[model samples]
Target: MKHGRNLPKLGRKAAHRDAMLSNMAASLILHHRIVTTKQKARALAPFVDRLIQTAKNGKKSLSARRLVARQLYSPEAVEKLFSDTAPKMSDREGGYVRIYRLGRRVGDGAETAVVTIGMATIKVDKKEKKEAKKHKGERPAGYDRTKDEEIFLEKAAAKSKTAEESAEEAKAS
Candidate 1:
């Protein structure tokens, strides 16, 4: 009985499949759209959708970012997913990704598809847009960057020092 065991193997080992999916998901997050074999695109759509769903959970708390980071394997991609991509779909309940068939590949004639974030076509509601704006970490309108830079630099230095200390402790242990 092959019940409930439906993740496509994609002709690769578990680690290889996971790694490929992680990379593809990161690329999708960074680029917003990607082209690949239909099989791979189908496999990737749900994977990316789940990540987007997780990203829709309010503002990017440290814990939420860390959870998505574990699956994305790219810090920048995870950051974009939470800060940018996720907010666009915050109002939508599910189906965060869309796949379009693009005829076939040139070499092996494999079926190809374009996977994209679903928010590109839909008009966002005003209320949702306002809510999304609050989570984006944008400065207040007409804010003065010159005055803020000092505070920003101080916070950045402190964060880096803590990170370095943690790394050093791990090494010593």
Candidate 2:
């Protein structure tokens, strides 16, 4: 019996290796970048790239992230997050990562690649924020009350029901 299977079963054990890669991939997604062995980067690049591409489609639901986290089970995945990935791609509509081939690894002979995801910008309505500031003391959306108008409403609400209206309503009820 072996006492320490403590480390991740990275290679040779295939499924476990895949799981480890997936975990690393998820983290890379959230963090936007990570440094690792060239072999690992190579394997992880495709997985994480695809994951970000999935998020690019705007299916960035809690369920999707949770499912990704389940496949990835890595602390990195949750922390690194796809928040940027989804929003960035929300504009472009496709193709997230661009892989650049770097030279060989220092330790091992594995080939290195720098995988970058496209963080395109979508111009959101800054005017909405401006409008919000302008209307700060004014009514909320769909509320057409001016400050004076709102005060009038508040006073109207504060007023005791008129006896005739109350009596009529009471009679109707």
Candidate 3:
């Protein structure tokens, strides 16, 4: 009996859903990628693709620009859409967005995913090219694990221990 149902409600009313989708579309244009729930990403993919297609289809027309601008309210997003994203994607016909599932959320267990423009790229190390190709779903090859907070925590702990020992020696003296 589940027929003729097309739209995903996303637990929001019509106006709210429209606003949220519009903002999400703008954010995706600005950042090139965004983390969101799988369902939301699915819904947003086609919406954003159509916007990109519109921009691509009519890059020079003022009316086309105005039409896309009406959908995405942000000025920067519209500018990027017209200038960078649209031209970058003009070679392709469609399918502008890609969604990758990233397991479930911790608190609610909802399925999460990342949606990115298909052309987004990151610098990768030449040595890890094979490994990076094997695990394309993860980050780019140049990711720095040394910058992680665990290293900072270890350094802080060592400093704190040394400080405690120096304080103990001072107290004894």
Top model by TM-score, which number?
3
- Model 1: residues >4 Å from true position, as ranges? 1-5, 121-173
For model 2, the stretches where C-alpha displacement exceeds 4 angstroms are 1-11, 36-42, 58-60, 79-82, 120-173
Query: What's the lDDT for candidate 3?
Result: 0.90
In candidate 3, which residue ranges exceed 4 Å CA deviation? 1-5, 121-124, 130-173
What's model 2's overall lDDT? Answer: 0.62
- Write down the lDDT that model 1 would get: 0.87
Can you write out model 1's per-residue Cα lDDT over 39-128, one digit (the tens) per residue?
A: 999899888888887778746578777778889899999888887888888788998888889998889999998888886643579999
Clashing residue pairs found in predicted model 3: none
lDDT of 3 at 136: 78
Worst 10 residues of 2 by lDDT: 114-123
lDDT of 2 by residue, 1-173 (tens): 86864533446486778767776666556655555656666566566656665554536477667666666776565444555456656666445655566777788777776655555222378899898788788755676548778899877876655766888899999
| Candidate models: Cα lDDT each | 0.87, 0.62, 0.90
Error of 1 at 59 (Å): 2.9
TM-scores, all models, native as reference: 0.66, 0.48, 0.70
The TM-score ranking, best first, is 3, 1, 2
Stronger candidate by TM-score (1 vs 2): 1
